[model samples]
Target: MDWDKLRIFHAVADAGSLTHAGDTLHLSQSAVSRQIRALEESLNTTLFHRHARGLILTEQGELLFDATSAMSRRLDTAEARIRDSEEEVFGELRVTTTTGFGSLWLAPRLPALYKKYPDLKIDLMLEERVLDLPMREADVAIRMKEPSQADLIRRKLMSVHMRLYATPGYIAENGMPESLEQLSQHRLICQNVQATQVSAGAELVRELLTYDVRSTLTVNNYFGVLQATRSGLGIGVLPDYVVEDFPDIQRVLPEVESKEVPVFLAYPEELRQSRRISAFRDFVTEEIIAHRKKMRQESESGA
Candidate 1:
């Protein structure tokens, strides 16, 4: 019933130490300990199991901690919403995306974004794992495929394909392959078939392996594959998005490529009106448009 006791209990449970919680709350250890005791007495249940090392949450404490954690996330979301301004976009925006795309594409363009919104704090989480948007694990995601999660405001950004690429140096060292049959002479650099990635990319790599290829190198993500390929390690199968920024890497086997993969941007439906979300969404859209225009120009000029 006492909000102050609940607050202290949450802090202690989070820190797993009364002294640490006291330090955070700017209260003495004795004061924090007394508050915990009072809360336990009021609830008539043990919230923590005291130990010499620190404190462990009891079953009751685990339940309460879960509730408090959810509350904390909700409060954070509320704070973000309150900070959203019509005239300015400034707040923490947790953005999640595949490591390859995040490092190769998004991260490079972030300087411009920071220049526009000097106060924005972007926590860029680069991993393949899909974070829970509704639960506030992350605020937005730009994924290789459409997100299937519920309660998300999804937008299709673009499509990409797994195509063979090799630096001119690599091609000079290992003679260019004229066809699928000729690929046997060169090493293949790509994501492992079992790695978490787009199925089309894995399928293309599998098909390439069917050839009489002798040397091969497999990385867990496209970023590593790109690096290896750029280093003249071998020919790499990478997403088409790289061609614009990495002009020195030439596309190989014009006739050979994987099925197209759709890219999507998604955020919680609750963030549909958020100014930060709008700013990010518009920024990405504008960038994609510019990329598309450049790609078209390159294609036209090459043709």
Candidate 2:
């Protein structure tokens, strides 16, 4: 019934030790124990099973702990939103994206963002797993496809295609493949078809495999594939965006490409007004524009 008692119980359940919880809460063990006892008496239930090593939550304690955890997350969301209302775009902004894009593309452009907002703290989570933005798993996400989750504000950033590439030395040494049939002569570097990659990329790799490539090197992520290609290991199936940063890697079999994989930036509807989110979204949009311009200029010069 008492908010203070609920808070104490939450901490104790989280730590599984009365003394440890007391240290975290800045209260003595006896004081914390008194609060837990008073709370249990008020609820008419035993919240934890006593043991010599540590305390274990009873069934009732588990239910209460679950409720408290939800409350804690909500409070965190509220705190972040409140901080966002301030004038400065400063504080931790958790961003999630695929390892390939995060490392190869986004990470390279982060300096400009830091220059503009030096006070901002970024926590970059690079993985294939899609975080739950609405549930606050991450504050923002840049995904290979449009998010299917409900209550998200999604924006399409750009589209990418998987294309073959190789180092000039590798091409000179092994010769280039001019057609699908000729591709079989060289080793293929790519993400394994079974790995967690965009459907379009996986499909391209599958089609490439059918060419009966003489040898293959499959990595779980595009970063690994890029590294191998850079090292002159073999022709690699990689996203066209990679060419922006790695101009030295020549595109092989230009006509051989995959279906378009749309990239999207998404955030929770509740964070629509967050200044931190706005700053990050605008920064990425600007970078995309600049990237497109640079590529176009190179194309015109070559033409």
Per-residue CA lDDT of model 1 for 1-303, tens digit only, reads: 788888899999999999999999999999999999998899899999999999999999999999888988998887775765767888899999999999999999999999998988999999999899999999999998888889999999999999999999988887889999999999999999999998999999999999989899999998999999999999999999999888889999988999989999999999998888999999999999999999999999999
Measured with C-alpha atoms, the lDDT of residue 77 in candidate 1 is 86
lDDT of 2 by residue, 33-152 (tens): 999999999999999999999999999999999999999899998898676657678889999999999999999999999999888999999999999998999999999999999999
Query: TM-scores, in order shown?
Result: 0.73, 0.73
Candidate that scores best on lDDT: 2
Q: For each candidate, how many residue pairs have backbone atoms clashing (under 3 Å)?
A: 0, 0
**Alpha-carbon lDDT, every model:** 0.93, 0.94
